[model samples]
Target chain A: MTYCVGLLVNAGMVLLSDTRTNAGLDNIATYRKMFVFEDPGERVITILTAGSLSVTQTTIARLKDAVRGPDVDAETSIMLAPTLLRVAEIIGNTLAAVRADVDEKLVAMGQGVSASMIVAGQRRGGEMRMFLIYPEGNFIEATEDTPFLQIGEHKYGKPILDRVVTPATSLADAQKAVLLSMDSTLRSNLSVGMPLDLAVIERDACRVTLRRRIEAGDPGFRAMSDAWSKALRDGFAQITL
Target chain B: MTYCVGLLVNAGMVLLSDTRTNAGLDNIATYRKMFVFEDPGERVITILTAGSLSVTQTTIARLKDAVRGPDVDAETSIMLAPTLLRVAEIIGNTLAAVRADVDEKLVAMGQGVSASMIVAGQRRGGEMRMFLIYPEGNFIEATEDTPFLQIGEHKYGKPILDRVVTPATSLADAQKAVLLSMDSTLRSNLSVGMPLDLAVIERDACRVTLRRRIEAGDPGFRAMSDAWSKALRDGFAQITL
Candidate 1:
């Protein structure tokens, strides 16, 4: 189980993901689920994954291979794709292929593997876009009315995002919104653990403006979490039932 | 798809349930999910159900039959049970039996049915008790550390309960907590809908002290929901990144 969120606002895009991965409760491991590919001022693509680790890792590895291949083309490589939509198509196809390949081996045991990802990025002239890619190779984009996309263990963290996020929200507030969303998830679920990866892309920058790895006990994250909890408690106490 | 919660605080017990039930997204209808049986000032038992409509409705019907049966005894009837635990056992066993009967008929269709329930009440001279009865007849009681039990579409409503509910929480506050919790679920899920059933049982009263049916346009519930949303938004705005 994992929790990853991608938010696209007028100011920029914010991506947050937890590092915990588990085949079962007893076999838990920490794995980075966020991948960044960039050509600086030309283009920047950040991928946040959740679900079967094998499928996600293999799909990402394949995408990386395509980027480094000598015959790199827009059709085969996300980095060279002409638009964010094309990039999403390439990643989605790769993810679906990898999942199918993995599922075949697990089928005999009545098991199957699958994964989904959030693709957030921009090209120099293309508008910033965020997509939620399904395991079957299809995707849905974030729209002005609904500026956020979440994958895996999403329900616990969703109420806050539904209440606070909007297309016109500032980049700083978007960061806070995603972090607090993750906080709610972490407290409610054990499978989503600490040491999170956070990335912020300023609009039209074509590069990540802020990157953070929040480890357990990190003072800043801890302070923000504590403050949010206190504020909620105070707010709750004030409500006249 | 339903949302039902039972909370036990020092002051008493509170039970809340959404009236929505659905066979699928296209086949939704309103159905009561909360049932109360009380021998006033002696014993009171409130059951909040969730899951397969067929299974839950059947289980409740059977329990009611046993209560009104001429051969009623502690072994077969919840109302005649010697203790709150005994009542839970009767309910759990009946639920499991009904589920097994229903599952058998659905198995040929490659489908199965199951349901769960939260039973809360106190018997004369017995301690107040709350139990979450699983489909297989097993049950777990809510304790001081976790004074609440929820069934069906629970995650969306859990964070608030986690933060606000405790054994020492006042009855009035507990009512607010459960209502706000339901408010969150109602907003996040389409399957959980309006016309909620709320029941409060004050300590030692052994009967429902307050009961209300909150329709879709109920003014008091609307005001509380609106105030809670505002409080949450304000709290989110005050948090710093």
Candidate 2:
């Protein structure tokens, strides 16, 4: 299990993902689930993955290969795609293909492999956009009405996002909202663990503006989590029935 | 679908439940999911249910019939049971039997019906207790370490309960916590809807101390929900990350 969220606000896009992966309770391991492809001021693409590790890893590997291979073209390479929508389409199609291949191998065991991803990026002279790519290769883009997309272990952390996030939220505030949302999920679900990957892409910059890896016992994250908990408790104490 | 929660605190027990039931999105109806069997000061047992309607309704009907039957006994009637633990056992067995019967009928459709329940009650001179009964008739009691139990569409409402609930929490505060929790669920899930039933049982009293049904437009509930949203936003704004 994993928890990855991408928020698109007026200022920029904020993306965060946990690193824990488990075959079972006893087989837990840390694996980075956030991938970035960027060409400085020209274009930037970030992908956050969740679900069967084999399918996600293979899909990402193929996408990277398409970007590096000699036969790279706009149709095959997400990095070469002319627009954010085309990039999403390429990633979705690649993810769907990889999932189907993996599911075939697992069919005899009455099992299937699938994965979903959050795609956020912008190309020079193109609009910034965010999308949630489904395992079936279809996707939904974030709009002004609901400018956040989340995949995997999403419910425990959703209320805070629902209450606090909007299209007009500033970049700094958006970062705070996603981290606090992840904090709630971490407390309630053991499957979603640290360290975490967080990236911010300023609107129209076509590059990742700020990126950080938050680890367990990281002082700043710990302080924020503890402070948020205290504030919630205080707020709860003051509410009358 | 339904959302039901039971919180056991030093001051008392608080139970809240939504009344929405649906076979499909277009076939929605209102059905009470909370049942109470009380002998006043002698004993009081409240059951909050979730999952397949047929199984839960039939199980509750049979329990009521046993209590009203001519040959009522400790082994057959929950009201006559010697301890709260025994009452839970009786309910668990009845639920398991009813589920098995229902599952057999649905087997041809390759579907199996199941239900879960939260049982909270106390008997005169006995300890207060709450049990989460699984479809298989097994149950785990709420303890000091974790004094709340939730069933059905539970994740959206869990973070607040995890942060604020404790054995030392006051009954008034407990009610607020559960209602706020339900408020979060209502905002996130269309399946869990309006007209909620709330009940409070004070410690050692063995009877419901306060009971109310909050309709969609109830002024008091509306005010509390609005205030909570405001407090949370204010709290989020004040936090520096």
Candidate 3:
């Protein structure tokens, strides 16, 4: 299982994903899921994926292949897609194609492969839009009322985000919201593990302003975990029957 | 969709379930999900179910029928069950039977229906026990590591419990933990709606000590909602990336 969250805020976008994948409990492995496509000042599009590693890894390989291809164009790849929507379209097409191919092979063993991604970023002039792409290739955009989207072992982490995240939230705070969100799930579920990838794209910067990898024993994460525990205990105490 | 939580703390057991049912987004309605069977001071059992209403309601009806029968016995009923575990076994078998019957009818239409419940309470002279009954009649108890069980739209509210709950948590604190847990899910999920049934059973009481139904505009719930929103905003501001 994996947990990936993408938030579109007035200050920027925050993307976080855990790197644990498994065919089963005993087959667990760490595999990073955040993919960044950047032309530095020109554009910075980040994709955080969850679900089948086969589908996401292959889809990402194809995206990278397109980026390196000499004939890359608005119609052919995310690198030159001209708009975030077009970039999403390009990614959706690539992901769907990869899924179809892998699923066909897995059908012999009665297995099905599926994957989804949160695509978010800023271009030289366009707005920082965020999208939650579905396995079927359709997508939903994050609006003011609900400024974030999450995938994978989502339930355990969703509460904090639902209560706190907003478009007007600061870039730094948004990162904390996602981390605390992920922290919640990590404690409840064994399928989701550590070595998290976190990226912050400041509004209109057209580049990732900050990137972090939080490991199992990171001090900052440890502090946040401890603080949250104290807060929950206090909150419970203050409530009346 | 539903959100029901059952907690087994040292103080006792707390069972809470939201009363909302929806066949589709446009066809939502309120339906109680909690059913209590108590020969007060003797045996007190409460079931909070989630999933297909048809299956769950039917199962509860059968159990009620057995309890009301004059020939009730361990072989034929829950009222005469030898132990709390036996009562759980009876409930699980009946729930499974109901699910199979409803699922068979729905199979022709390609629709699926199944349900699960959190059964918690104590029999006089017996230790308090809690079990999460699955659609297949299999169940697991709440251990020290996981002192609570939540069914239906569980993810949205799981963060708080992960951060704070333990078996030693006081009953008062556990109650607040669960309400906050449900509050998070209610905000994020439209399918899981309002008017919650909350029951508190102090350990060894063998009877409910407190119970209340929270409606959409319930004063206490409204106050908690506002306070939580403020605390989350404050918490976000206090944290750094």
lDDT of 2 by residue, A1-241 (tens): 9999999998999999999999999899999999999999999999999999999999999999999999999999998898899999999999999999999999999998879999999999989999999999999999999999999999999999999999999999999999999999999999999999999999989999999999999999999899899888888878777
* iRMSD (1 decimal) for each model: 0.9, 0.7, 2.0
Ranking by DockQ: 2, 1, 3
Per-model DockQ against the true two-chain complex: 0.83, 0.84, 0.58
lDDT of 3 by residue, B1-241 (tens): 9999998988899888999999888899999998888888988899999998888888999999898887776764776799988888999999999899998998999988879999997988999999999999999999888899989988778777776788888887787888888888888788988899999999998988888999899988888877877766666666665
Off by over 4 Å in 3: none
Better of 1 and 3 by lDDT: 1
The reply for model 1, stretches above 4 Å from the true place, is none
- Tens-digit lDDT track of model 1 for A150-236: 999999999999888999999989999999999999999999999999999999999999999999999999999998889888888
In candidate 1 the C-alpha lDDT for residue A185 amounts to: 95
**lDDT by residue (tens digit), candidate 3, A161-199:** 877777878777888899988888888788999999999
Give the top-scoring candidate (DockQ): 2
- What C-alpha lDDT, on a 0 to 100 scale, does residue A47 get in candidate 3? 95
> For model 1 chain B, where is the 10-residue window of minimal lDDT?
B232-241
Error of 1 at A94 (Å): 0.5
Clashing residue pairs in candidate 3 (N, C-alpha, C atoms within 3 angstroms): A155-B155
Best by lDDT: 2
After TM-score superposition, the amount by which residue B90's alpha carbon in candidate 3 deviates from its true location, in angstroms, is: 1.0
Predicted complex 2: DockQ: 0.84
- The 0-to-1 C-alpha lDDT of every candidate, in the order given, reads 0.93, 0.95, 0.87
